[model samples]
Target: MRVMKLNEVINITGLSRSSIYAYMAKGVFPKPIQLGPRAVAWVEEEIQGWLQVRLDERS
Candidate 1:
């Protein structure tokens, strides 16, 4: 599975950094994995799945 940083997440989701954190806090977004003491990233497939769910919701 691919991992994506915050910048990529922002690009793919079109959400601001604050919004991303907000969603995470509300359990709406996927939780990120810790890459190191100061780095974190999300699973690419998970993000894609989340997008798919949103798309499905519009149907």
Candidate 2:
């Protein structure tokens, strides 16, 4: 169970920081877990699952 930082998520998903937040706001992306007063990270498995869904949609 690994947690990924914002930059890692951006690289893996090829989404800009604003786009990731926008998708979250639209309820179409996984939310991040608050790690501290100003830190957050996403579960690696959730991100991978989201990616799988996108791939499946293309099939």
Candidate 3:
């Protein structure tokens, strides 16, 4: 399992930071794991799964 930071998430998903947070707010995206008071990261597998779902939907 791998943890990914916001910038990496942006690169992988091609989404801007605001869009990611907005999706999270709408309960449509994976929430990040809080690593520290000022640090957070998402599960890489979860993000990959999310991407797979999107790709599947496109088919």
What is the C-alpha local distance difference test score of each model?
0.97, 0.99, 0.99
Q: Please give each candidate's TM-score.
A: 0.97, 0.98, 0.99
lDDT of 3 by residue, 1-59 (tens): 89999999999999999999999999999999999999999999999999999999999
Please report how far candidate 3 places residue 44 from its true position, in Å: 0.2
What TM-score does candidate 1 reach? Answer: 0.97
List candidate 2 stretches off by more than 4 Å: none
Residue range with the least summed lDDT across 10 consecutive positions in model 1: 46-55
Error of 3 at 22 (Å): 0.3
lDDT of 1 by residue, 12-56 (tens): 999999999999999999999999999999999999999999999
lDDT (Cα) of model 3? 0.99
* TM-score attained by model 2: 0.98
How displaced is residue 5 in candidate 1, in Å? 0.3
lDDT of 3 at 39: 100
After best superposition, candidate 1 residue 38: deviation in angstroms? 0.4
What does candidate 2's lDDT look like per residue over 1-59, in tens digits?
A: 89999999999999999999999999999999999999999999999999999999999
Off by over 4 Å in 3: none
